[model samples]
Target chain A: MLFSRPMIPIDILVYGIGLAGVAAQAAAGVLEAGRKPFDLFGVVIVALAAALGGGSLRDLLLDRTVFWIADQSYLITALTAGLVTFALVRFVRLPGKLFLLPDAVGLALFTVSGTQAALALGAPWLVASLMGVVTGVFGGIVRDVLCNEVPLVFSGELYATASWAGALLLIAMKASGATPGTSALAAGVLVLVIRLGAMRFGWRLPVFSARL
Target chain B: MLFSRPMIPIDILVYGIGLAGVAAQAAAGVLEAGRKPFDLFGVVIVALAAALGGGSLRDLLLDRTVFWIADQSYLITALTAGLVTFALVRFVRLPGKLFLLPDAVGLALFTVSGTQAALALGAPWLVASLMGVVTGVFGGIVRDVLCNEVPLVFSGELYATASWAGALLLIAMKASGATPGTSALAAGVLVLVIRLGAMRFGWRLPVFSARL
Candidate 1:
């Protein structure tokens, strides 16, 4: 016990938002895994990929210790969510369409979180905005790919666009000397609203029809 | 010119091998992109992703500036290879099987390079070995997923296994105080031989057949 390391306490507000994001993403991962009807191990793998994949990639790109490695709680949360989802599928009659709600929530939260992290790290506004979009969408892309689906970001309705909008807004707020708390709250709300609206209205980007 | 940063000279042997690896991976990426018949920009994107993705991920996790960002030569090499491959595809009657050779060579080189990088950064041997395998395979995985194919590493003949072997061998050699030159050369050769042999012999890992 003398050599035991203590758990590092994170800020409560950040932890709450991050936990919600993890839970939502992990649930979405479980749904994608079920589309493939992968085995238990594969389900966990996909779930973890969905929950932590983007943040891990972002952290790696930013040259920081991966979040799950630094804090075991995130991994535990993802695993629990995956298992609960798997069990729920066996017992409850859940609609397949239910996954999108949590997926949107996760995307919105991650967009703000990634952008904030980048800004704190001294990234240029443009790069920070791009990173936010990448963090928001990359995990879902990984999940879709692992399930043998073409990544939805390539064709999905206004996915990355929503993240980009929210990120740009965050950058603008920061430049205007807004408090971090106010900027993050407004950005998260903006992303969630845009994303939900896009899904509800069936908004989509026009596909290029020309052959190159 | 007064404000220009000096170009740092890299060890010629490492530079040669790394350049070859980047070119080979970029060419393979170009080939993969052609499967989707992507636009010129998409092809270039995938090629850059395939060439730099793995190393970037490794460098980020190791808390180092990405190699391509720090040294423009690597970027130039990857872009040129991608462009050359794109042009060649229009003129040459390349068999699909031709991709495997360059891919195998790239994997071998990347495995050794990744391990050496991790070791230099003071990572434990086990972590270094895993990093090596990750660097060797991540690019191809990204390429396949973007092209809407199941990654070959998920079911292919001894792909990760070869990289793991090479990485472990490198770690062992390094622990025993072997010269960096000897360790890297031996590890690279080991991976190449194993990968080639596996492909030639149709070696594959057993699929998990049990229902969960």
Candidate 2:
């Protein structure tokens, strides 16, 4: 009964958005992997991790069947996107920032979906918000980790913060009796705008190094 | 019926070994975190990840309840061990290699437990064997990744290889009708001996740099 939601039009739209988000993350993963001298297997592994790691963690924590495993479309989409990006990059000198916009879009979509999923499960407010942040940013963290680099989210400009803000807004809107569609749309837009604005304005969190 | 096994003496012994493995990984995590200038929270996070990451992943893949959440004893044990190591190291400069023996023991214990769990769930042979290796080494991988270093299991002296070898041996023994306890004991010893021997003899896998 966990995933027995009636597939209304809004649900279909959300599903499409989720697939797009997966594709975006997988493409970004391939780009990141290209920076290192990894083999084909390594590249695919990184791509899969980047695309599926966040949602998998969220589902596992919530004891839900993993989304990709429940529906293989997500897996196929990630793999196809990754392979295409890998092949494209080998031939063309694409700009490093080409993925920035799509990445932001993916972040917004994932945040909305993740928060909604947690709330639907009747999770506590704080846990729901954190799950949203995790789904929005953990993929990038996993990608960076696999590449043996510091997780970009931990030190980057307003990425997870943007996701968290939107998650909170989504919860607030829902509590204030907004329709689910309206709340989801508003929250997703907020996340996207904040992420894009942060990049454009070079906003950053304070970097602290504790001596202890 | 998943975890409905009778709590026989062997099960209790295995559970005790599992707890010891968790503690060992947690202590090793603290030692690694000491190298970085992380605060108390960061140290604890790293400790928990190193102690629980592997088993969590295995359980998630198999759709089983996460061990730490199902039993709080594992969480308490990891936290206590991490804090104790943290406190001890502040007063006394422990040798850098102090945790090696415990880490090896942990790898053996985790490999045996993980393989057994997966096989009980009726996972195919290859999947079950890989689950064992995942449980044996993924913690170290997560720890090194959080520290922004290449995974020690991927680059170090025959760590995951030893784990995989032991996992395969476990499966073969079980298939040949060996007693469960005997198979577990042999496999655990094999992993420990191979890991220790690799460390002492400087055994290593080929380090390849592919141009593609």
Runs of candidate 1 exceeding 4 Å displacement: A1-48, A57-64, A68-141, A150-212, B1-11, B210-212
lDDT tens digits, residues A88-130, model 1? 7776756766767767777878898889889989999999998
Model 2 vs truth, CA RMSD: 7.0
> Interface Cα RMSD per model, in Å?
7.1, 6.1
Candidate 1 iRMSD, 1 decimal: 7.1
| Among all candidates shown, the one with the greatest lDDT | 2
Residue clash pairs of candidate 2: none
Q: What is the CA-based DockQ of model 2?
A: 0.11
Candidate 2 C-alpha lDDT tens digits along A1-212 = 32333333457766887888899899888888777665554566578789988998898889777776555577788978988877777667767787788778889999998998899999999999999999999998989889987788888688999999999999999999999989999999999989999999988888898999
Q: Give candidate 1's whole-model lDDT.
A: 0.80
lDDT (0 to 1) per candidate: 0.80, 0.83
Q: Residue B200 lDDT in model 1?
A: 92
Show model 2 residue runs off by greater than 4 Å.
Answer: A1-10, A205-212, B1-4, B7-56, B65-140, B146-148, B152-212
